[model samples]
Target: MQIGIPKEIKNNENRVAITPAGVINLVHAGQSVAVETRAGVVAGYSDQDYIDAGAIIVDAATAWGQDMVIKVKEPLASEYQYFRPGLILYTYLHLAANRPLTEALLASRVTAIGYETMIAPDGSLPLLTPMSQVAGRMAVQLGSQFLQTQYGGKGVLLGSVPGVAKCHVVIIGGGVVGLNAAKIALGMGAQVTVLDINPKILARIDDEFEGKVQTLFSDHQNLTLAVAAADLVIGAVLIPGAVAPKLVTAAMIRNMAPGSVVVDIPIDQGGIFETTTHATTFADPVYVVDGVIHYAVANIPGAVPKTATDALTAVTIPYAAKIGKLGVTDAAKADRMIFTGVNTYAGELTEQAVAESLNLPFHSLSTRL
Candidate 1:
């Protein structure tokens, strides 16, 4: 099987689908690996590195025409035409808020697997975890930086002096992003409270933090109170194939302190905060809303491409090798764990959530497979 790694063309998305070592692994598994010229450039991997790993260097046109085309982000409108029947296009297809991409995949009849939805047998996101870790840590740092007076913030420091109190951070969803934000805020000696709908996840947070960070059952009332008092609010809720439940209202932002920040990390699935329209960039992260700042960089992990690239490829490569060796049909059957987001089969939206999102008829991939 021939696998292609296309250079990520998403704005500010510097991370590639696979790495040099990943190519070597695929090659050793008796699969052909093709790396688009400079695919790993921003990730600090030279073209020579991929070539050294036994991957053939190719141009965009040829790479897109391979048996399997793995990408880091959802393809743009122009790239949608690259999809064809029997082609495996694996990437982060955040199709809930995205209608065009879903339509294209359906029209092209490509067998698509979403990296973010590829859950492990244990119900954990092996592929998405690395990005969650990076984005979570970045939320705090970005929030802190954006809080500067120059950046139109309150000019308060995250870590305070002897008598001064540290800023408060209210993190929604005590999953990976919330926990990571809590860790960073704790390290900075700031007050942190994490809110989540799942009591089990809240319990896990309580145990992990050992009473350092506050874990509360997420509710509108509790969330409003926390947001009003917080200097920074991180929106990290996720509902697999559904639009992100709006946890923070626009009116809620008005209640918050002036210059307080809201980082909506789940902007891809329609953000948890009402103010989030679409993804923002690291270049200009903050936008004033009712005297509060909003840091909604949907692709926060891309800011640190090198780290995100390495972490993502660590888990992605092994699976890529499996898909490359077994082919999409056999790979989907053999690798149950990696088949979480099978949106289309021979020519159907097999995933119910994706079908519902696009208002298309649902067809289970099981029958087709």
Candidate 2:
């Protein structure tokens, strides 16, 4: 089997799909690996590192021309020309939000596997968890930075002074991202409140925080009030393969304090705030909307490339190896979880949620196989 590692070309996406150590593992498995020159450079892995691990250093075209291509983020428009029939693209394909990319994949007949949609038997997103943890933690850190008056914020300190009241932080969705955000916010001595649709998740959050953090049922009334009163609002909502539900409206943003900041971690999945027109890059991360600031960088973990690359490759290597050893279809036939990751298979939209979201016809994986 031949595997390719392409340099991530997304804005400020420094993390590569696989590390040098990951290349060593694939090489040990008797698989041929091709890495684009400088693909891992920004992630702290030198080209010699990959070469030493038995990977061929090649140009972008040669790397993308392999049987299977693993990448950190989805391919941008310029990279679309590399797509070909029967090529396997294993990456985070947020298809519900990017109709053009989805169409390109279908037209090229590429087998697109989305890391975020892959679910383990225990109903956990194994590949997506590590990056989610990074993003969740960074959400608070970035939100805090944007809350300063220098960054057009209200100058409310997150931790606050001994005599001043702590900042109020509201987090929407009590999932992995929300939980980590809450943990960091609470650690910083901020008043934290988390809202979610699942009562069990909220209960778990309540138990974990032990009354230090407030848990509320996520509803229109509660969400509106929470956002309005919050010094920082973290939109951490997710719907797996579907687009994120827009819970915060423009009116809600207008009602928030003039300097309040809203960080939408699920911007890759179409964002949880209605004001999120497009994803912002780290170069220009925030935008003002009705006097409220929005931090919706699609790739938050990319800010810490080394940590993110390590975290991503740790979980993705095994799956990538499996797909390399046995072809994508064969691997999918063996593991339903892997099958669940297939968004588009041989020109068919196999993921129902993505198809429904895009108003396309859905074809089950079993039928396609």
Candidate 3:
């Protein structure tokens, strides 16, 4: 099997899909690996590292021209020309957010597999979890940085000084991202509150934090109150492969205090806030909407490439190997999780959530196979 690792061309997306160690593993399994030159440079691995690991250093075209292409982010517009029928694209394809990319994949007749949609038997997103943790943790750090007066914030410090009241941090969705944000916010001595639709998750958060952080049921009334009073709001809501629900509406943003910050972590899957227009790059990460600051960097983990690349490759390598050993079609048929990851195949949308989100016709992978 021939596998290609293309350099991520997204804005500030430094993490590569495969590390040198990952290449070594694939080579050991009798698979041919081609890595684009400097793909792993930003991730702290030099070209010699890949060469030492038995990977061919090639140009972008040669790398993309492989049987299977593994990448960190989805293919950008420039790379669309490289798409061809029967090529396997394994990456985080947030199709619900990008209609153009979705159309391109279908038109090209490529077998597209989304990492975020792949669900294990236990209903966990194995490939997306590690990056989610990194994004979740970074959300707080970025949110805090934007809250300073220098950044057009209300000038409230997240961790208050002696005799000063701490900033109130409100986090929507008590999932991995929310919890990690809460952990960091608490560590900074800020008053934290987490809201979620799931009572069980809220209860678990309560137990985990030992009543240090407030937990509330996520509803219109509660969300309205929390947003209005919060100094920083972290929108971490997620609905698997579907677009994130707009819990924070324009009205909510309007009512919030002037200069309050919002960090929408699920921006890749169409953000949780109504005002979240498009993804901003790390070069220019935030924008002002109705007097409120928004930090919606689509690839938050990319800011820490070394940690993110290793963490991402650690989990993705096994699945990539499986797909390489057995062709994409056979791998999808063999593993239910892999099948779930198939967003588009043979010019049809295989994921129901993505199709419904985009108003496209949905086709079952079984039928396509």
> lDDT per prediction?
0.85, 0.94, 0.93
Tens-digit lDDT string for candidate 3 (9-116): 999999999988999889988899999999999899999999999999999999999999999999999999999999999999999988999999999999999999
lDDT by residue (tens digit), candidate 1, 1-369: 888989988778889888888888888999998889998998999999998999989999889999999888888888987888889888888887888888788888888888877777888888888888888888999888878888888999998778998899889988788888889988888889999989999989889989888888898899889999999999888777767888899988899989888899999888998887777776676678899988877788888889998898898888878888777777888887656757667777777776776687888877877
Alpha-carbon shift of residue 20 in model 3 (angstroms)? 0.9
Give per-residue lDDT, candidate 3, residue 49: 97
Using TM-score, rank the candidates from best to worst: 2, 3, 1
The Cα error of candidate 3 at residue 45, in Å, is 0.5
My TM-score estimates for the predictions, one after another, are 0.97, 0.99, 0.99
lDDT of 2 at 181: 96
- Model 2 RMSD in Å is 0.7
RMSD to the true structure for each prediction, in A, is 1.3, 0.7, 0.8
TM-score of 1: 0.97
What global local distance difference test value does model 1 have?
A: 0.85
What is the C-alpha lDDT profile of model 2 across 140-234, one tens digit per residue?
A: 99999999999999998999989899999999999999999999999998999999999999999999999789999999999999999999999
The Cα error of candidate 1 at residue 106, in Å, is 0.4
